[model samples]
Target: MNDQNLLERYIHEVGAHLPRRSRPDVQLELRSLLLDELAARGLEADNPADAAGVAELLKEYGHPEELAARYHTEQFLISPLAFPAFRLSYGIAAAVVTVVFLVGLGLRLNQGGLDLTELAGFLGSYIETMLLNFGVVAFVFYLLEGLGWIKPAKTGAGWDPHKLPAVKDPDRINRTELLVGIFFTIAALLVFNFVPHWIGIVSWHDDGIGVVPILSDQFLTYVPWLSALWVSEVALKALVYRAGRWTRRLRLAEFALSLASIYVLYTIVQNAVIAKLAIVDGIAKFALWILLGIALLESGWQLYRLLSGKANHPLGVPSIRENQ
Candidate 1:
């Protein structure tokens, strides 16, 4: 067959399995590569007898397997980190995009200025972005699977079923740990809300749930809910730190609860009290940011110790580097 014919079949075979959005580009590139390889082998499209030799050359290049592997390696699941992170980030992005699209549609329907044509145009753009994102993510996972880096184990004699210990505990939150977590969490809340209000950064709420302090400015809200969120997060972190093992289900429950609390608080404050809070504007904000930074560092250090099998001691247990 001619170079064009050879390239057509080759590109079709490979691109058929790839993401549709990227199929055209990948097809073009693969065709070019095949032509170059054929040319390098001294094969000519003009000579009719050179057809079989060209076919043989294409066959030797391996039945689109190597090309598929290359596509996977170069474009998708490049590493272990990339694999799981891609899944998470893609899921989050998809959710955000879906919400934005729905909101835009609702707004357009409510507003009289937006005609059907304009609505269709806006929707077309949204659909395009959604499709492109989905294709890219799918291709990434496909590539990762194609490569051996993320391949499933063959389950042979070398595997020891009993030696692999479980990292999770069914009873994750014990009474003692839970009590201690509540204590520290309550203390932190008192420091942030009550103490700050006493010093004039905010005001203590006397009307409703008086345990949490409310912001002084009517235009600045979301403080109470945010304080509650931070408190819960601190409690969860404490539980995890003290126990060191929790069921996946429990961890997920905690995450959902914390996020829901933040979202609800944000919504209520934005609608009822103030649209936004200027957490970036004051000494209190700066101090809170500093505390957050220190907490992150401490958490990271603790995680490192756990991973390095040195988590026998509690958090803040210094290493040799600290002494140095």
Candidate 2:
């Protein structure tokens, strides 16, 4: 009821949640700090010395939630999963112990509960073994973290919370970068298809026509290059959904690969079928032109992102709120 009692009660409440090894010392330090804070506030008026008045003052000072939270460290020396919340570690420990206990108890029960007079002897044996194994597992996880096998992610001190830039909804990803992806798709088609035959690596079979190989005979032998071309095309499109400097350039590289693949596919198909090629030649040429048109437009867009330099340093760090 008095100042000392109120501080003691607060200490007892917090100490109950802490590890037994440090509880006494933590309680004493907290008790002294609380008293000091009250004295500084000059709440030492006559009734302030009274237990009820002290209780009200302590209540006004708030539960030491902040003090309690400090005990929960982001220390890499402990399991990332472990914390001041003993229940996290205890639940796992207890569950393991419980399972072992249950198995032992079941085996004994199945033997017909025959040990009536010496029940404590059997019970003690079961608890001891189960707890020993449980403690081993708990300590192993702690030690593994302490040994730096499972490293904790950077937080607090490593990251400059104050340096974080402000976020704006309007500053959503830049629109021009999306155009780069479209451009790459087109450029890929032209580079692979329309290029002069002075660079034909391999002619498809006997036919004068030959399409480029996408996967290559050494790679898969039969799968057409068109498949890889299409796949890369789709992937490039997907990458555009993300707006970032590095990703933007990676998208460009993907586009070039896709285009070269298309060229190889065209040559492979052209060399494989000579008769039907005439029928498909016009259609293929038309497709390449359309792709080139799109590519030109996209190139202009990419140029804009590069000139603006936004593409050069695209935001690498993600927005935390989005992660949540």
Candidate 3:
């Protein structure tokens, strides 16, 4: 494509990644700046070197997602600069909690599901544990950011343009999303393995709202397998976040997980009385079936993507490649 097309495409890609609220204004500013720069260099569609010029200009601009991140003011319990590390720490804490509770529950409970009183006790424990762990992490980060002890990386004269990451595919993995996924995966593993009663019915009480556990005896039997699958998911997501892109092996691993999910869901839906309440049990089963379908679809897609000539490869740093 010509230089104008390349410029528009680049703007489109960056705009696609930006938050909707800021997208239009950012895209407009980005387009005007790029066009002006191109004009100053006399690099237009008529110029033979236009494509290379546009690419060079965009490379200097930075990674699309990084650029989009700049336009965003969105943050969580902490600044985005500190969030990636905090998320990993959160996942580790979740895993620790899961392992400890699972061991304790295994020692305390028999082969059957928890009774109403036992479920209530576990619910209380869950509330207390959540408050402690989540509160500590949130408070510490909040204080750290508020104190300006944590800050974004500084860009200066020493910064190397060649250090810019390779131009990612449109489906580039979002590290924040992956990190959050890892955190939630571990949380799922913990909740199901320890406080299975967490997923229950909500009702009004004299004091306040209360939950009646929907978990059944048959569901307890699958706890070990579900825990293993969720842990695997967390590990895979963590690896992907660290790698910053998917590799052939990672895609294969994801495919395997997708297949495993399909099998587990399929098995569970087969006469599995997963919940105690009839309505809840039917909804749970239906949800499993829906999940099973999704897994199957994902498995098929992964297989096709794997067999296709265009498989995911490791991301290369742009400057590193240019230097090499």
- State which candidate has the highest lDDT: 3
TM-score of each: 0.31, 0.27, 0.48
CA lDDT, candidate 1, residue 47: 61
Quote model 2's TM-score: 0.27
Q: How would you encode candidate 1's per-residue C-alpha lDDT over 130-162 as one tens digit per residue?
A: 889988876866676567455423222333222
Best by TM-score: 3
lDDT of 2: 0.49
Tell me which of candidates 1 and 3 scores higher on lDDT.
3
Write model 2 residue lDDT over 15-110, tens digit each, in one string. Answer: 544554555556666656767776776654234345455555555544444344465554343332343333455666766665555555444543
Better of 2 and 3 by TM-score: 3
Q: What is the clash count for each candidate, in the order shown?
A: 0, 22, 1
lDDT of 2 at 21: 50
Taken over the whole model, the C-alpha lDDT of each candidate is 0.52, 0.49, 0.68
Q: What value does the lDDT take at residue 68 in candidate 3?
A: 67
Evaluated against the true structure, the overall lDDT of model 3 is 0.68
**Off by more than 4 A, model 2:** 1-22, 42-87, 99-111, 116-125, 147-324
